[model samples]
Target chain A: MKILQVEGLTKVYGKGDAQVKALDNVSFSVEKGEFIAVVGASGSGKSTLMHLIGGVDRPTTGKVQVDGKDIFTMNESNLAIFRRRNIGLIYQFYNLIPTLTAEENISLPYLLDRRRPNPEKLLEILGLLALTDRRTHLPGQLSGGQQQRVSIGRALINDPAVILADEPTGNLDSRKSRSIMELFKMFNRQYNQTLLIITHDEKIALQADRILTLEDGRILRDEAVRA
Target chain B: MWLSKRALETLSQNIRRIVDGESVDLLDNREGPLSILRNDIQTLVRMKQEQADALRHDKERLKDSLSDISHQLKTPLTSMMVMADLLETAPPEKHAELVRNLQTGLTRTQWLTDALLKMAKLDADAVAFNVRKADAREIVARALEPLNILLEMKGQDVRTAGEAELTCDVRWTAEALGNVIKNASEHSPAGKPILIACGENPIAAWISVTDSGEGLKPGQIARLFRRFQGDGTAGYGIGLPLAQTILRGQNGDIEVDGSGLPPHVAELTDEEYSGATFTLKLYR
Candidate 1:
């Protein structure tokens, strides 16, 4: 299914003199479970494009729809609920709640809803993260590698239709970076999770199922990675 | 009189070198008596200051490490002793009980060591921040890979959308995303779905991880960014804070969105789930 659609999205900042065209007539569509990598120079408006699609910010012009609903049309309150219920976001930083343990961080989405946490399943996640022993530890206590795993757990906790990550491995070492990439590949293949990431590392970018190159607020190239 | 005259000349030359901002080689062996005296004195003073500074920094570091180590060891040691005490008193027929106690103790010790290691690394500046550009989805996938089996076992599925390419630290972000996703997958009900999505706006791009588990309390959300502070039963309190650090370090943020009538698993289609949603907002 076509999970997300963007049409004629244009975002402009400031007025005539100080005006900057961050996104100029950008449009794209994503299927339900495709891995996408967006590669761009420092100021290509690639980040802007991501913000518009995720409803973090509204576009100066154009339409954005997730699962066929126009996100722009939703009110602020509705958008908040919709975003929480529909999207999974990840960052270079783990963003796991520092005060929350690994398990609590993963379960936060559910906790926000006042629902009972599923115990057995949480154990399984801890096992997968090799965090069973570290479950009670704080984020400040875990290694960069382990902390990132907890963040991933938090993202997966919600199981949204789309997974978006920005510079996910920007702070780890090369070995850890490769390990993380391997994990992403494993999830994409095993769970068929649709992933969209923004990065500048060539090695990381080439690992994606699809690559979109951006420069100066435009799509420079789009290609599919060979299996 | 001749010796005094030579000493005065040497002192004046040494002072001139110091004022000129030139490095004076103490061993230059300038036979001039005054130059030799001044060089010797200057070298001795410089060496003494260097030693003093080194000693000071080292002492400070040692003191901090000792305190941190003691603090770190306290909880684990206490837990271990309690568990051990319980096991020692348990009846011989309670084999399962003994085993449980031992396991809990071991787990606590392990947790303490892991925390200490990270703390040490951070303190020593052992963690390197090598930023770069790469695919955000690739990072997410990498983060999610280890959690695949967990999701499948829980009878839950994780999904993603769009091309998620970004410029930042791949290792850091992947770790962050992985932690968040893993948390959601673990807490939410089995057979439920967790969704991950990415898209762009004019100012920045966003990657969101949403789960269909219980939502957060208003009080918890207010202080969610603080360290080691979860009201939930299973929280280690490190995951979200680490994630926040990683994000903030990269000029990004992790925000929680809990609106009226928190969405539930029942409300989510195979398309949506009732869990937490975390957004990683990236700027240009």
Candidate 2:
């Protein structure tokens, strides 16, 4: 099933003279369990496109339907709840709560919903990420590689449908970056999680199941990887 | 010419090092030229400052570029996370694990982006507070409220004393106290007593969470709030730093007395020594 659909998406900021087109008439669809990468230069509207699809920002003209629901149609309060329950977002700096341990960070989504975290499932992900031993430590204590793993666990805590990562390995060294990508692969293979990542690094982008290139607020290319 | 002269001076210093313990000094001329050389050294320092100023400007520009790149990556990653999360709730079976992983991965990325953003914001001096009069005891309760279940689950208890009312930002103060209490709850074992006391001293309003956990060794006391510094754990090492940030933002502070004050723990049970106690102070 098509998990995400974006049609005629255009995002414009400011008015007439000062206005900038962040995304212009962009359209795309993503399949379930696909690891996709959106690549673009600094000025490209790729990030803007990602924001529109994520429901973090509304497009000036277009529709983005995730699970067949128009997110922009919802109110801000509902959107916050929806985003928390459905989305898992990761970034380069590993935004685990500074005070929360690995376990707490992983369980944050569920905790937000006022539910007890599933220890069994949490332990499983912690072990997979090799963070079981460091479960009690704060984000400040973990190595870059370990901290990223905790972030992965936090995203997984909700068991959300899709994971959106932007330059998840940007801060790590090559070794740590590779290991993080490997973990992404492990998740794709083991759990069949749908992933859409934004990356500047060519190697990182190439590893995606599909590549979508954006330039000057437009989609330049979108293609699946060959076996 | 000036650059060349400085280079020559540096060359002579290297040559002096090579002179095998001889009484060699750059300005030690037999003509009593030390005073003149000192004046020249002062002039060189002034010249170097001008050059260093230019380098500082370049460094700031590079730092700005990196910050921009980080934001560029972060903005989209956040959106993608929302999209992935929305998609995760789709079909029940076809790509369950894939969906789970995507959501998880996205969350991880989002967190990292948040830290970078916070760091950038801190660097940019964008983290300002709206400090006001508030209650200290109430703030502690509010921060501890979320973790009440966890405390209960661990068979732990918390008590408070002193007037709850004081002056500070309710949210920021709560956040600081939350960190201290949460740290105590997580590090110490179950069925132990964790005490949170709030009172006003002559200097500042004090709030302290004393846990009956293994006390910190002399080593852990130092480098306590350093970022990414932890005792082999999964955290990003930002709690104490963040607490410090929040407290400091409110013109308050946090400290640790791995050897905390007495009465706070004199009658404590044996299980309470596994972790250390932390105290926070804020202005009235």
Candidate 1 error regions (>4 Å): B1-284
Task: Give i-RMS (Å) per prediction.
Answer: 29.8, 32.3
Give lDDT tens digits, candidate 2, residues B1-284.
Answer: 12356746774674465345332223221112332343234324333433555477658755764755566566657766676766667675646665666677677677656655665565455877666667776787789887899899999888655564557778767866776787787677789878776666333566777876776743465455655564555445555666776766665666565644433333333333445667676643
> Which consecutive 10 residues in model 2 chain B have the weakest lDDT in total?
B23-32
> Model 2: runs farther than 4 Å from truth?
B1-284
Q: Per-residue alpha-carbon lDDT of model 1 for B99-152, expressed as tens digits? A: 877787688668657655654554455777677877767788788887888888
Tens-digit lDDT string for candidate 1 (A1-227):
56688898999999989999999887888875688899898899878988888889999999997755688887776566566556777788878777888788888766765553578877866765668999999899999988888887777665566778888898898667756765665466445567898998866775676788888898888876521
* CA lDDT scores, all candidates in order: 0.69, 0.69
RMSD of each: 25.1, 28.6
Q: For each candidate, what TM-score against the reference?
A: 0.45, 0.44
